[model samples]
Target: MNLHHNLTKSRLRAAYLVALLTLAYTLSFIDRQILSLLVEPIKHDLSLSDTEISVLQGLAFAVFMGIGGLPIGRLIDRSRRMSIITAGVAFWSVMTAACGLVKGYTGLLLCRMGVGLGESTLTPAAYSVISDSVSPRRLGLAIGVYSMGVYIGAGLALIIGGAVIARLPVDTMILPLLGEMRPWQVVFVAVGLPGLVVALLMMTVREPMRRHDESFAVKIPLSQVFHYLREHRFAFTSLILCQSFAAMSSYTLNAWAPSFFIRSYGWSAAQTGHAYGITIVVSGMLGVVSGGFLGDHLVAKGFVGGRMSLMGAAMICAIPFAASAPLMANPHAALLMLGVITFLITLAIGTGPTALQELLPNRMRGTVNAMAVLTVNLIGLGLGPTIVALLTDYVFADPLKLRDALAWAVPMMMLVAAIFAGLSLKPYARSRSQRLLTQQPVENA
Candidate 1:
């Protein structure tokens, strides 16, 4: 009876922790993605091109995330992780709010860099924290649940932005102290302010115990982390590249789907928001969680490289849909194909991080995760949207041909992703086998 009671309490605690982290993640996405829904208005007001918007969405954010992630990840490994997350949430929240005040491209770009840097503190710490709190068997599902924030925040960004924009006039509105602000500016402030409350809530979280005792006794050097990667260079490189490609494919759609729908289908922002937003949230959440569970099930059945295998399979399955989705003349057909593609692509999101956690020792989790963050964000967030814009502006030289850009880009990326995933399998399995032979019992909270 006591054992059962203790188990229940522990599960409850884990649930709460995952819930809080997920909420922070969701808010981060909202702040990052709200700009997507406001692309047209912001472009009109700022006199910007699609290329400039891509820079704001991708490069500006990616560069800073790449810069900050490694250091922040190292801090998470050696310091009070909860404190780091709290500070990050606070910093990013303020930066997000500051975005509301930006009058031009440079200011907005700088603020976006700030937001990226602040958000860089999140996933590495959260991954390490959650790894310590849950048993290995549950790690994939737990992380999947946490990762749901990506889609949730994304969906909510559209939904909430849609609701707000629907109610407000498209023109500038005057406020008491703020004077005049555009609707997009107001949306930024509205989404950004709530993150402060999330930052406060994060303070209540206690840092869970490290999974290994030696993690407390000895400091792992950054040199050793790199050495380990070099030692398993094939596996690590393949895995990271595979994940980066997968992320690129997904981020491309997320960043541009609103604009695509508006330009191609003649849909209003609110209509696109309600339709596409609901599809993403539902499909993304289901896909992430299902993929994690499937990976876990496969691992239990003795496929040590199950996660990598699933990633390869997902990319291949998504190819047809990716090729077809953007090219559909009927908006309904395009949306249906997009929903299918989202489900398939997102299946790998949670698995990539979970796979990394399984390979690294507790001490190296933060730094390695940070590196993963850097690579994924740079390739995925930094380049994905930019690639599409370049294709639209330079290759097609016609903005209306955005669908052709997507049709060309997404399948090609997914093909590369599949190749990377296949290459990683043998090496990843070998590495996991070696690690498992010396694996210690993970300390569950």
Candidate 2:
């Protein structure tokens, strides 16, 4: 009876902590994505071009986030996880609100960088917490729940940004120090300030006990972490790079799908935002859930590298639909195809992270995850928008060519991602075997 009571209490705590971290994840994406909706207004106000706006949207934020994740990753492995998360929430939230106060492109860029750096602390810690708290049998589903924040936050960003833009009067003063600001500027504040509440919520979460972890090894230096990664280069490299190429394709869509609709179908930003945001959230929820349950089920069934294989299969299956969706003449038909593509593409997110935690020792999870974050940012976030912009600005040159550029770019990226993920199956299987062998002695002891 006492054991049962303690288990129930532990489960409840895990649920609440997961819920808070999920909220934090949602807000980070919301803060990150709101800028996408503001592109036109920001461009007009700042007198910027598509290329420059791409830099602001992805590159500027991604570079700093990637760089910052390294040190934070090491810290998460060693320090109190909730404290790192709580402070991160506060810092990013303030920076996000500060975005509303920026007077020029440079100021906004710096603010965006701060937002990125603050957010860099989140994923490693969240993953570490989830891995420690959740049972291995249910880890995939738990991670899936956590990952839902990605789609939910992104969807809300579009919905909220669109709603704000549609309803807000230009330059209405809310505070005395802040005079009249543009509607887009006000959106940043509206989205950014809520994170403080989330920070406080994070403060309430107890640091989850580390399981399947080292006794004193969390304090290992960063160089030693790199040496461990160096020992398993192929598995980590393929996993990170595989997901990155796929993510690049998704990030491309996230950054410009609204623009695509506006240019190609002559839809208003509000219309695109409403439709796309709804589709992403609903479809993405289904995909993320499927990934979590299916990945765990497959592994339990003795399918080696099932997670990587599942991600690869989904990406491959998504390719044709994502590629052809933009080229459809009928708007409804195109949107329907896009909805399908969105669901299939999102299957990768939930599986990959959970599988990654299973691969490495607990002491190394935070740092390696941080390295993965860096690689994803540098490749996917940094280059996705830039490549799309280059294609649209230089190669296509015509107003109607945006859809064509995406049709070409997205499929190619997915194809390469599928290949890399497929190649990783054997390495991942070997690594998983080695990891399982290490675990048996520890369990026996």
Candidate 3:
């Protein structure tokens, strides 16, 4: 009876931890994605170019997220993850709201940088905590559940931002003290304020203890982290390449999809929001859940190659649809195509990350993830949208031609990402096999 009761308690604790991580992920994405929805209004109000908007949306945030990840990852490894995450949520929440108060590009940039810094604590801490709390068998599912937060939060942001901006009187609204701010400012406030509630909820959650203690005595130095990468050249290269290209392609679509709809199909913000919100929710939810299920199924069948297979397939299948996105005649057609592409593209994200976690030791996992995110965000998110903007501005040179330019850029990136996904297979499978081998003797004992 005692044993059964203890098992029940353990299961409940695991469920609770998953819920907390999901909430953290949701807030992280809400803060991150709110800027995307406000891009048009912010650009018009600030008289910013596409390149400038890219900097606001991607570069500033990526820089801060990259720089902040290492220290935050270290803290999460040593300190209480719940507290770190709570503080981070609070910090970003406040900064996101502060964005509403900023008038010029300089102020907004600084506010975005702050949002990046605060959000940086999320992935490393949350990933580490989930890995520690959940059993390995369920890691992919936990990651999938967490990944849902991105779609859910992003979808909600678009819906909420669209509704508020559409209904609000942007031309006439004037603040008594600060004068007239755009409707976009109000949208930011609305989206950013809810994070305070999330942060408060986060504060009440308990941090779980680390699972492995044998390696705790010898602190893993940064050099050792690099050395481990140096030792496993193939795995290191595969992880970096896969993450970088995938993130590039993913961010490209996410950053520009709404604008694409408006430009190509003459859709309103509210219409685009509803279409994207519904599509993302349905397809993203399905893809992530299916990816987790597929990964577990493959792994259970003694096919350590599951992660690579799933990722490669997703990228390959997504390419044609993504490439054809701009060519669709109407909004409904474009959305249908985009829905399929998003589902396939997002399918690989969580699986790849969870696979990486399985490869690294617990102590080194956070450090490696930080490094991965640094490369992925800096090169992928930071450069991808910027490159697309530059290409649209320079190469395309016509507003009417911008959709074609985006189409060209995204498909090419997806193809490149697929190649990297293929390249990741051998190393990932080998690493998993080796890890299983290393654990066998201990299991036998």
| lDDT against the true structure, each candidate | 0.92, 0.86, 0.79
Candidate achieving the largest TM-score: 1
Better of 1 and 3 by lDDT: 1
Q: List, residue by residue over 268-362, the lDDT tens digit for candidate 1.
A: 89998888899889999998998899999999999999999999999999999999999898999999999999899999776888898888888
Q: Candidate 2 at 49: error in angstroms?
A: 1.1
Q: Which stretches of candidate 1 lie over 4 Å from their true place?
A: 1-4, 215-217, 443-445
Deviation (Å) of 51 in candidate 3:
0.9
Give the 10-residue window scoring lowest on summed lDDT in candidate 3.
436-445
Arranged by lDDT with the best first, the candidates are 1, 2, 3
Model 2, 1-445: lDDT tens digits are 9978888888788788778888899999999988887887788889987788889889999999988999899888888989999999999999999999988999999999999999999999999988888778888988898888888988899888888787876555566678878888898999999999999888788888777765745477778888878877888888888888877987888898888887788887678778888877888788888999999999999997999999999999999898799899987788788778778877886688887888878888888889899998888899998888888889987646889888999999899889989989999899988888887332110
Q: What are the per-residue Cα lDDT tens digits for candidate 3 across 1-445?
A: 9978876776678788778778767767777776777777777788988889889878999999999998877776666778988888889888988898888999999999999899888887778888877777888888888888877777777777778877998584787775677788877777787888888887766776666547555677788878878777797677677768777877877787877787777777877777787787778778777787788778988888788788878888888887887887877888899888878877877577787777777787777778788888898889888888888778887556658877888888777778887887888788777767754222100
For candidate 2, give the lDDT: 0.86
TM-score of each: 0.98, 0.96, 0.95
